[model samples]
Target: MDFDKIALEPIRLDEAFFHKLPKVDLHVHLDGSLRLETILDLAIKDKIPLGIETIDDLKAILKPGYRHKSLDDYLKGFDITLKVMQTDEALYRTAYELAQDAAMENIEYMEVRYSPILHTRKKLSLAAILESVLAGLRDANKDFGIESGVIVSGIRNISPAISMRLAELSVAFKNRGVVGFDLAGSEYNFPAKDHLKAFNLILSNNVNVTIHAGEAYGPESIHQALHYCGAHRVGHGTRLREDGDLLNYVNDHRIPLEICLSSNVQTGAVADLEEHPFRFYHDLGLRVTLNTDNRTITDTTMTREYLLAYENFDLLPLDILDLVMGGVKSAFIPYEFKRDSIRRTKDKVKKMLVEEAVKQGVTP
Candidate 1:
């Protein structure tokens, strides 16, 4: 139990070790995280025109893990997935499958986010869209033992009035299944302040707020998200380090940044892993948590994200413990829930590391 005295350090750990550790995914997208084969299956079931029948052909077109020229370019992959998600069955199946996949990798908790308006093309009511996905998550919780919640998103590129509508949905489902409200979409020209009405409504209802900022834009976007929109957490804050003053404010406030490594690289948020600010932010004592922003689209998993940190950053067992604990703290759950998770995750990781050290013939 005396972790400080133990020399349990592994900079480059086996991927299987990462898979064995209990994990939390706080920022995965439901629409973009679909399995390619599921997309093809749903497309065939719904008679949607994907022009491809095979998974390999679909992968060649969707181009999972493809490095793109810009954030918008990286997002174009959603156009294909959205085609088959108009029905309740598609939404339910995708949500269940995503949770099942996350559970298989030992993810104990997950929060999936998406815009209901995007799935309304087939005359589905907003409430119905939300319920279908919630049902899938509920079933997955029963079958796979993975707890999950939904974060209804208001698209930044869309109108503020629409964002307000989504905010209302978040409030209506506050204790039912929805945990938080988010502003996600093209953040280039669409500033977070433009969605102030939505955030205002969300805050008035005491709903949690997390906005996508400083990824496709600069630190100024992050500033707007915090100052104007009143975001509790930031998504893909890769550019927050560009402004030292803002970075210090975030650090002092202990605002968690949901950093998605592979997605950041594919979206051109950072040039590459060497250019990523994850190591910089962590070294400065900021609350940074790793996530797979889009699992299938970015071809990443919770296990892969942790491995990226292990290989790219010089992190010790305690540092990895800190990162894992950071995720529990950033979750939108109640404080009492987070306290339990933080304690349990710390104990589990420490015990696992001790065993790993023993396996390597190190003194316990």
Candidate 2:
């Protein structure tokens, strides 16, 4: 498609994109986006020795060119971040700071996912771990005015029965800030069907379900997540581009796909920014949302992700607004909240774009 030849211009960082845009991030991972400085402090607090000490070293750990040979390889970097986040205090602070970071990037709402089961190794019960994360999210909401929802992921490598237990916990903790349930990790070997029992439980309890599929595996994974697991949304459904019928089905069903650009590229899901099917999905009337899958790990933000789309796709303000609205529409929160967010975001974007349009003497 010669995406490299697209006449898209980059939006100035503090100028057009960041200050004026309103963003909704639907697929951010809480554990994957921890701040390096915070990680260092947490490691110090627990006396856990990190091989790389300085911020630069942490950046190298995060951006290791050859380190992430595949999706599994990319996820290995999270081991250190997860290790330092064992305590309640550490979890709370990390979640709270993540919310604050989202706000700073002009994100009105975000759905941050993580596996509480992984954090339970510190003797903290599942409920306790979820509670601590919720507490941080709430505190951040109060402090930064950024609303967020938590999606508890059943690690793909985990046992089906254990995953079912997590789903039970999700259904139990529904209104307590846990918005949905997801299955993640090793997409190829651990198929979504393996976790059908857990998803069935979640479905029986009327919990929202979103699955990570079509990122590594092709359209079959997406099909399983939508048809079998009953996912309302698919995280990183990049491989769906290979299947026209499935892509059409997504649009027909109005299912949202959370597209994480740099993560997909870094993990070798898609080749890079230019080859991303974001524009194709958008043009096909599919509900595609932009996200920073792992903020610190990928060294990105919602603003940067949006800007990347804008520049790489040569998208105008209206296009960016529509993409942002797609995320808001696909959000897991209540309908009323989604409506309000879209309303406010539309007004803000209209006002900003009107100003820019007038300044540039461009017709709206």
Candidate 3:
């Protein structure tokens, strides 16, 4: 019962250990995850005029570290990425490479979310954008054997009417690659409740919903996402700890908190990694899942995120396993698929633990 005493024991985890661990990422952004090399190549090929001719300059401009003055500052990097992602080919390649990148780190299942409306600047239709991204994911699955789904996101900074149209698109692609609807964007002034009509439409059509809340704001934003928008999952619910009663409500209801630690710090959601609420939420038995909200922008991988959690929180291998299982349970996939994936992940983790114990000459 004494968590402090348990936390004192060190658990050694290496890159190979995390690379072999089956994981799930429920909150990765498609446009935010294009490869750096891919971005440069696309920029030159498409003549997108990114202003940065070299990759070093690009990294300096885009790959800001795990701390920022504010969320808006962190979001500035998206402008360059989005500029190049305006075409069907760009969208398809980014989605496919995102899946490939996750699969390299042993992410067996992932749900990629992006605002399709953002990709239409090149005169591509909304349906064309969606299908292009889906096509890339489909091809990646065929090649890498990683199961993937799409979550159509409605940006709060955008119009509510546009959100409604995105909700309709999500419904149309429900059983296809698309699995859920999300409300994501700047979380301070743009409240999730403003987009309630889209959530209502999504819910009415029996679709899943997750909202970005409590990252830049506080518990009130999270409350709106849960109470008004009816989110099944909460993206970066970092401020939920401020409201004990609401935290208990989320815990009791088993709402999964998609905790993107690196992105949280980068967006100034939390002061730093040490101040992050992930350990607090996990210790209190909240359903917390790890994710890379933006791989390219944050310059992170699933393995790196798990490693960061291990190093920052001193989470044992078992704790990391629990988070992985929590992510699988919180995924938008069907119940049957969730069960099978959890089982497979558990078996893999068990085998890895035994191997690690044997290597250390310790009794399992």
Candidate 4:
């Protein structure tokens, strides 16, 4: 049972193997994951200006890879997607499709996040936008048997007053479908401390809060998210590796880091996959989980992300299983629900591993 040796050995598991593994995605954005065809249809139907007619052209604009110049450049594609997402029907369809896509890859649990205020350009109430997304997810759950919830995000570049409003919106829908509150968007000049009011409001309401920090900025950003804002989890704390004391504090406190590999690289958070801190964080026993921050925008999926980890990081089957379980553990759900979900998913993962071991002529 030399796990390190096994991890170092070349493994031959294919896409099918990863597809069957039960997974959880704690930090996926809804507005950034619209399918290309769906985007085209929506743009045409709503007369949204995409500046691109064909799918190939749209892909070029939206599917920028990991070599992006900076976080700001990487976010340019959202302008097109968000434009078409201002309607109730568009919101429902996008949310429904995101769930269906996650279920197709055996992502049993997920928290899809978006800023409700961003969708209100069409005069739609924040409540209406939230309900539409919830209705779509609820329908997807009934149809596909995938458990899902919503995390309302407040933008960092936006006004703090608006972030406070979004926090209240999240608290208002606490049990209905909203599970957490998050602060997303750009990370450079826009500090998380600026939105302390929103995070405090979310905390006061007994709601879970995760803030985007250390992606574009330094560990001080993450420190503010934890010390000032009281974040329960951290999104893309990639730069935490730069600060030894703070990194140790995060490990000691067992705060989970939502590590979206491809998205991080695409946003210039890391030099490349080889330089990523995922292995560093995991080896240090930090509660780290892999995610596809923007599935469509990054042109990735949960399965693809797992496969990339396997190929790049040389993670063994057990390591991959642990990562999947970490995501479930880091989810913003009730303790009972988290325990039950992990129990069931672990059983399934064990069974899958046994089957794979047998197929590979290895002892289970």
Which number leads on lDDT? 1
Deviation of model 1 at 326, angstroms: 0.5
The lDDT of model 3 is 0.88
Encode model 2's per-residue lDDT on 84-203: one tens digit a residue.
Answer: 888899999999999999998788888889999889767999899999999999999999999998999998888998898899899999988989999998897888899899999999
Question: For candidate 1, lDDT tens digit of each residue in 170-205?
Answer: 999999999999999999889888888889989998
lDDT, candidate 1, at 144? 97
Worst 10 residues of 4 by lDDT: 1-10
Best by TM-score: 1
TM-scores, each model vs. reference: 0.98, 0.93, 0.96, 0.96
- CA lDDT of every candidate: 0.92, 0.83, 0.88, 0.89
Candidate 4 residue spans exceeding 4 A from truth: 1-11, 64-66
Please give, for residues 163-233, the per-residue lDDT of candidate 3 as tens digits: 99999999999998889999888887898888888889999999999999888899999999999988999
Q: Total clashes, candidate 2?
A: 0
TM-score of 4: 0.96
Ranking by lDDT: 1, 4, 3, 2
Give the 10-residue window scoring lowest on summed lDDT in candidate 1: 4-13
Candidate 3 segments whose C-alpha is farther than 4 A from its true place: 1-10
Tell me the deviation in Å of residue 235 in model 3: 0.3
What clash pairs does model 2 have? none
Distance from true position, residue 328, model 4, in Å?
0.8
List runs of model 1 lying over 4 Å from the truth.
none
